[model samples]
Target chain A: MNILAMFKPNRDAKHYPGFGAVGVLFFTFLYLPILVIIAYSFNSNRIVSVWQGFSWQWYASALQNEGLLNSLRVSLTVALFATLVATVIAVSAALVLERGQNVKHAKLSQGVVNLPLMLPEIVFAVAILILFSQLGIQSGMLKLILAHSAFCIPFAFLPIRARLQGMDNNLEQAAQDLYATPLVTFRRITLPLIAPGIFAGSMLSFVISMDDFITSNIVSGGGATTLPVYIFSLVKQGVSPELNAISTLIMVASLLIATPCWLIAKRSR
Target chain B: MKKLSWNFWGLLPAYLVMSLLMVLPLLIIFYVSFMTSDAYGGYKAIFSLQSYSQIFYTADWDDNLVLNFQYLKIIARTLFLSGATAVICLLVSFPVAYYISRQSNNMKTFLLYLVTLPFWVSMVVRVYACVLILSNDGVLESGLRFFGLIGDIDSLLYNNAAMMVGMVYTYIPLMILPIYASIEKLDTRLIEAASDLYSCRMNTLRSIILPLCKPGIVAGFILVLVPCLGTVLEPMLLGGGKTMMLGNLIQNQFGVARNWSFGASLTVLLLCIVLLFLMFQAHRTSKLRELS
Candidate 1:
C-alpha cells in the first residue's frame, strides 16, 4: 500500500477543501479594481465615477496639460539619473561583498545598505527632508534625485549580488591561469555573465524611482512635482476622467518596461 | 596589499553614499527630535523633551496638564489596522500560494507572473482604482443599484472599512509572493509519505506543512505589515482625509502644523517600531535556521 501510494497519490491528496474557491476569489479581488480603472478611463463623462459612453477625450486632454507634461519630464529625469547612479554603485558593491572574502565589516556594510528597505519609507523621506533643509539645499529636482538614488541602491544591489554568487568561480580561475589581467578578465568574462542581472536591477530601480510618491511628495516641497505627486494633487480635488486617462497611460508604460525586466530576471534565474 | 586597496576603493563609493545620504540623515533626525520648533517651520537648536512628552500629555484650557489620548489613539488605530491587514493577507495568501504551488509547471509560472504583475503598477494608481469603485455612483455602486440592493446613491469611500479594502488590495501581492516562494520549495514526497502511513490530511498539514511553511507566513506577515503601517496615500485617498493614520499625522506635522521637531520625534517612534519588528523577524529566522 505504501509503495502504490508513493507512485500515485489519491485524487484528493493535493486538494484542500475551499482552497480552490479561495484562490479564484483572490485573483478576482486582485484584478477587479484594476479592470474597473481601465474601463472608467474610456468613460466619456467628466466625473470618474459616472460612465456615460466610450470616448478618448480624456486622453487627449491629459496629453495637452502643461503641468502634467512638466511633471512627467521631472519624473523621467529623476528616474534616469537615479537609475544610473544606483546601478553603478550597486555593481561595485555586489562585486566587493560577494567576492571579497576577507573584507572587514562586510556583513555590517550589507546590513547598512539594506536598512532603507527595512524601514518605513516615510521615515526616510522625513529624514532626507530634514537633511536637505538643514543644509539649505534649495533645488527640488536635486533633492529628489539624491534621495531616490540612495533608496534605489539596495533594489539594484541584491540581484547583482545574487548573480555574482551563483556564477562558477572556476571560470575566473581558469582565466587567471591563462595569465589574463584582472581588468581584462572582468571586462570579458565577469561583466558579460552578470550583464542580465545589472540590466534587471537597473530596470527594477527605474520603476521604483518612477513609482515613488511619499518620498517625492515630501522631498519635492511642491516645487518640482513628479507624475505621482501630480496625480495625487489632482485626486485631492476629486477624481476626474482626465486623471483616469493619465493613470491608464502610466500603468501601460510601467507594464511595458517592467515586463522585460521580469522576463530577464526569470530567465536568468 | 595593492589589490586589497583597489577592492576597498571600489567599495567606498557605495558605502559612502549609503552612510552619508541615508544613515547620516537618520542620525540627524535623532538629534533634531530633541530640539525645539521655531515659528517659521525651522528649528530652535535648544534641548527639549516636549516633542516626546506631547505624545502623552496636553495642556488644558485651565493651563493644567492632562493625559492626552489623541496621539495615543492614532497610534493604536494604526497598529490595529496594520495588524488586521497582515492577518487578512496571510489567510488569503496561504490558500492561494498552496494552490499555485500545486499547479503544473507552466501554470505555476503563469500564475506567479500574474501575482507579480500588479506590483509593477504604481501604488497611487491602484489606490485610485479603489476610489473609482467605491465612490458614489461608482462602478460597484452602479452595479449594486442595478441589482436593486439600495435606493440612494451614497459613497462607500472615506471610512476605515473602505481604507482596509484598499490596503488589502495594494499589499496582498507582497503577502502572496513570499508565501508562494516558500511553499514552492516544500517537499511533496514527504506529504505523500505522511498520507501513505495512514495519517489524515489535516493532521499531515497541521504537523508537517504548517511548521515547514511558518517562515514564509512570518515573512509574508512582516512584508505586508511594514508598508501597511507607514501608508499615507490609502488613508488620505480611500479614507477621504476623515480617518487619520500615523503616516498622515506625520505629514500634517511637517506640512500644515509646521512642527519639524515634533515630526522628527514621531518619525523616531515609527523607526523604533519598525526596528523592533525587523529584529523579531531576524531572531525567528535564525531560530528556524538552527532547527533545520
Candidate 2:
C-alpha cells in the first residue's frame, strides 16, 4: 500500500494544497497595498481611510502643484542624463571585461566596478557628501548626475555583460575574416546584437535614478530636489490623497516604460 | 599585449569615474572616522581616536568617561530586526518560489514578471501604502471592525511589529528570486527517483531538495539580511520615528545632530560588518559552485 501510494505518478504532487494556499496568500500580500494606493488615489473623501465616492480631484491638484512639477522635471532631467552616461560607460566596461581575455586583474577590475551595487546607499551617500564638501564641490543637479551615474554603472553593466556572454562571437569572427575592420564588425555585428541588452540596461538605470531617495536627499542642494525627496518631505508632513495620486501616476509610468523593455529582453532570451 | 592595451583604453572612462567618485569618497569616509567634529557641523583636519572611543564611552556628570551601552543596544536591536526579517522572508518566499517553479512556462514567465514589477515603484511609496493599510481607521483596521473582531483596538502602525511587516513586504521579492532561480534549475528526476524508492514526501524534501537549495537559501538570506540592516525608510515611516536603528542613527548624526565625525564612525563600523558578511557569502557561493 505504501509503495502504491509512493509510486502513483505524483504529477499532481506539485499542486499540493499547502503550496497553493501559501502562493495565493503571499501574492495577495504582495499586491494588496499597491492596489489600495491606486484605489485611494481617486477617493472623493479627504480622509485616506474612508472611501466616500470616486473623484479625480487629487490628480488635478497633483498636476497643478508647482513644487511637485519642478521636482518631476528635475528627476526626468537627472534620469535621462544619468542613464545616457551610465549606459555608455557600462557598455565599454562590460566589453573590456568580457572580451579582453588577456587583460590583467580582470576580476579585481570587475569587482571594483560592481562595488557600488553592494555598498549600502546610506553609507555611499554620506561618503560622497563628505567628499564633495572636502573638494569644495557644491551640491546641485551636476553633482546629482555624477553621483547617480556612478551608482548606476553596475545596474547597467550586469545585463550588458550577460548579453555579451551569451552572444555568439562567430559572427564577429566571420566579419573579421571577410576583411571587415574591427570598428566595422563592432558597429555592424556586435552593436545590433547587443541592442536589446543596452535598452534594458538603460531602462534599469533610468528607473533607479528616478527612484533614488537617500542619496539624493543627502546630496541635493536648494532648487535641485528630485521627485522622491519632494515626496518624502510631503509624506513626513502628512499623508494626503494627492500623494496617493502622485504615487499611482509614478507607478503607472514606470510600468509603461519598464514592461516593454522587460518583454524585449524576455523575447531576446 | 596590443589587444590588452586597447581593452584598457575602453575601460578608462569607467575606471576613472569609479576611482574618482566611489573609491575616493569611501577612502575619505574612512579617513574622517578618526577625526574630531568641529563646531560648525564639520570635521577637523587633525586626526583623533575620539570618534572610535565614543562608541562605548560617554562623559558623566562629573566629566569622567564612563561605559555606555545605548549605541550597543541599538546595534543589538538592528541585528535582531534584520535577522528576524531574513528568517520570515525565507519562510514566506520559499514556498512561493517553489510553487512558481512548478508552474507551466507561460505561467512562470507571467508570475515572475508580476514579482519584479513592484520593485520598480519607489520604496517610499510602498512603505506609505503600508502605512495607509495599518494606521488608525485604515484598511486593515476598518475591515476588522466591519467583521466585529474587537472594540477600540490599538492602532497597528508606529510599532515594531508594523516595522517588521513593512520590512518583510518590501524585501520578500529579493528572497524569492534567488531561491526561484535555484528551484527552476532543479532536477525533477531526482525527486521522482526518490519517490520511486518509497521515499516519503517529507523525506524527499528533507534529504534531496533542502540540500540542493542551500546555496540559494544562503544567497537569499544574505541579500535580504544585509539590506535590512541598513534600511532607514521602513523604520522611519512605519515605526513613526519612535524606534531608532543604526541607519537612522547615522542619518540623525548627519542631519539633526550635525556630528559628521560620529556619523562617519558609525558608517565605517556598519561598512566593516557588511563587508565581512559579503566576503563570507562570496566564499560560500564559490565553494558551492566548485562542488557542483
Tell me, per candidate, how large a share of the native contacts it keeps: 0.67, 0.63
Residue-level error in angstroms, candidate 2, position A167:
1.2
**Tens digits of per-residue lDDT for model 2 on A194-262?**
998898899999999999988998889856999999998888877788999999998999899879977
Docking class of 1: medium
Positional deviation of residue B32's Cα in model 1 after best superposition, in angstroms: 1.4
Across all candidates, the chain A TM-score values are 0.93, 0.93
Worst window of 10 by summed lDDT in candidate 1 chain A: A6-15
Candidate 1 residues B1-292, lDDT tens each?
8668866977898889988888899999999889988878978999999899888899889978899999999899899999998999998999999999888998998888888888788888888888878888887888888898877746688988888999999999999988998888899888888888888889988998988888889999999999988989999999888789999899888888999888989999998888899899999989978987
Q: Write the per-residue lDDT of candidate 2 for residues B10-104, one digit (tens) a residue.
A: 88988899999988998988988889998678898898988888889998899899998989888888889999999999998888999999888
Q: Write the per-residue lDDT of candidate 1 for residues A97-164, one digit (tens) a residue.
A: 88765787887878877878998899989888989988999999999999999999999998898899
DockQ for candidate 1: 0.67
The per-residue C-alpha lDDT of model 1 at residue A65 equals 99
Per-candidate TM-score against the hidden true structure: 0.96, 0.96
